[model samples]
Target: MNSTAVSVDRNRTLKMIAREFYHGLTSLLFPAICIVCDQRIDEPNTVVCHNCWSDLKVLSTDIVKMKQIPEQLDTILPVFEFNDTIQKIIHGLKYSGYKSSGVHLGRLMAAQLPQDFLLKDTVLMPVPLHPLKKRERGYNQSMYIARGIAEISGNIIRDNVLNRVKNTVTQTHLDAHERHANMQNAFAVNRSCDLSGIYSIVLIDDVFTTGATMNAAATVLKSRGVASIRGLTVAAPI
Candidate 1:
């Protein structure tokens, strides 16, 4: 073996050892715990333990298709059922400052999609959050989800093109009709964005309730000549 190649191998091994040592030290000082169960998490890069992750109900493709997809969207893909487990995880992500949960769920969501679901020319677009609400939250949760999906799907995210024009109230207690009304005219596309070359878009969000939010965002993109559009969410109500 050449001396140069041997030296490169030694450097790579040294770097890997350094990383492992750092992770071990960090884990010892600050133990990771599951978001849902509050149990210690031994996994290197996850907040939820394997058992809690297994408890999440996976949605069948047929069931997802049966759900109410907004007319503006061609279809919607949801990963998990919106049961008690999901509610807790989402609550943490939205209210408890656990933004990493979004990314964790997003990767799982994207991994289940068909290979062609996200094309080379397609981009990920997060449902826009109002500037005021975004300031309060300190970050947009959907952006993290999109980032995670992009990591798995190899697609670019186009969050800059969509803006939430309305500071709509929370849809938590609202009926389906009320949600629809609240999201009307809630989104507007930026006129300066060059979307002509974009072939498709997949909207990412944390949850799917009545499809009201996704529909409102899609309406604006459709007006701008975006022909192919769909929605992806971590979970949806049964």
Candidate 2:
């Protein structure tokens, strides 16, 4: 009986090893391409080439923390300005089916979070997607970003705590006021969700542009008794 148990454990371990090897090989076969230049990269793990990586301007966390929110936005932070390169990359990730790029950008955003943003009991709640759109996309980009942030901050990701109740139009075309109006009544706390213990959270997203999205999300979280809410994004329009 003991021999059989040992053999089972060994098989499980081998299966895990095999899975890793297969994943590695598959990644190498495709190779990650630079979103900007469309060149095959030597590093299969990162989306941007070495030159593009160096070109990306890492926005200062201090500036973000101290930056004044415009008349409309309550709180906001963007790690990079929205330049042509950034616009191209974000467009590809959001509209062009380059899903892996979300992971890379998420990591960059994670690196820009304030040092103390990940408090002792902080949670990561990404902006939720509408049900139908999420189904079409196969996954939420914000959730992907949250996963990358989770890897670095070691914060618990509570993905299903909030959900989009309305399928709204793209915010790209809306003005600040219209954006807020469009998102009105769009999200709600999950009916069966639990929020009794969480004290703080950092809402993660791919970019911070109009600040409308973050405001709406934070409003919902504040209503749930969360004490502190901060926003983090990979790119901000600045």
Best-matching candidate per lDDT:
1
In the range 1-238, model 1's lDDT, one tens digit per residue, is 9999999999999999999999889888989988788889987677778888788888888888799778999999888999887888888888888888888878887878888888888889988799999999998999988988889888899889999999999898999899999999999889899889876999999888788999999998999899989998999877
Per-residue CA lDDT of model 2 for 1-238, tens digit only, reads 6999999999999999999999889777977778788888887556667777567787666756666553333456787877777778777777777776777777776787668767768888888888899889877887777787787778888888888888889899889889888877777887687787887777777777666777777777778887777777778754
Q: Please, what is the whole-model Cα lDDT of each candidate in the order they appear?
A: 0.88, 0.76
Error of 2 at 29 (Å): 11
Q: What's each prediction's TM-score?
A: 0.85, 0.78
The C-alpha stretches of model 1 lying farther than 4 A from their native spots are 1-30
Model 2 score (lDDT): 0.76
RMSD of each: 4.9, 5.4
Q: How far is 38's C-alpha from truth in model 2 (Å)?
A: 2.9
Looking at model 1, the pairs that clash are: none
Give the Å shift of residue 94 in candidate 1.
1.5
Per-model clash counts, in order, read: 0, 0
